[model samples]
Target: MTTSSSPLTHFDGQGQAHMVDVAAKAATHRIAVAQGRIVMMPVTLALILAGNAKKGDVLGVARIAAIMAAKKTSDLIPLCHPLALTRVAIEFVASPEDSAGVASLIDGETGHVSCTATVETVGPTGVEMEALTAVNIALLTIYDMCKAVDRGMTITEVKLLEKHGGKSGSFVNP
Candidate 1:
């Protein structure tokens, strides 16, 4: 597990929740990337890949939802600073087989769809939350779009892949 030497910044000595002040910090270019995956029935994945989902264009709509979610992160999370985002990129990939390299079997057949979101901004604080938010919204969009057919779809491994800029410096998941 990863450990931090510094104390949590979102709380004061009294343990009251509060937003961290970044006004005194200098503006710098910041970027963060987050990713997640959804596992669903192979047939459901086929429907999505074949563009036959009842909702229409699942990935395309999810991409747009991710960008919008990144921009609106501050509104969704109270402690987050509202910074002017410079860029947001969302990508989705569909895999016919699971990571275990198992081939599609009758009832056990499964498909994986992954979403990655990269968010960039020039500001005092980092955009980690924005990137994470984007990934979550994207996955949720996928779930919403295909839930009628695959109610058992599971979203997993939602996490920050890396981050750059800010006083704390850079971090990459190992």
Candidate 2:
């Protein structure tokens, strides 16, 4: 785990929010990985897996949304600096069993669809926000596509799993 004693960089001396300046910071290879999961009814998950969603290609469209979200992170986040991302990768995993290999029965027969997004850029600022945003958008896209069938679906545990580069060095969630 990485801990920083430094104060929040987005606030000025007067306590006003502002974007941090990265003009003098050296550009380095930056990578960030984020993950999240959406839980839905087992039947809903089966529908998605069988490519029977009314909106069509739930995972495929979510993948594209994740990539687009990574590229547009700065636009969505006020203090984020626009980055020239080198790569954006998205992965989806649908599992009926939990990590322990036992059926994850929650709220009466549920299934989990996990999204992992890896965003990379060569820039002064880290791409952590971009990666996190990608994961969120991807999960939201899935929810949007399946809401009609599974309105009770929940999106949870969205977070940055790890990040590398910039003056902060590296960080991994413990």
Candidate 2, 86-166: lDDT as tens digits: 999999988885575444556676898999999999989999999999999999999999999989999999999999998
Which lDDT tens digits does candidate 1 get at residues 1-174? 334344888877667778998899989999999999999998888788778999999999999999999999999999999989999999988886446533343677688899999999998999999999999999999999999999999999999999999888999998
**What pairs collide in candidate 2?**
none
lDDT of each: 0.90, 0.90
- Give the lowest summed-lDDT range of ten residues in model 2: 97-106
Give each model a TM-score: 0.90, 0.90
Candidate 1 regions exceeding 4 Å error are 1-6, 97-107
Residue pairs in candidate 1 whose N, alpha carbon or C atoms collide under 3 angstroms: none
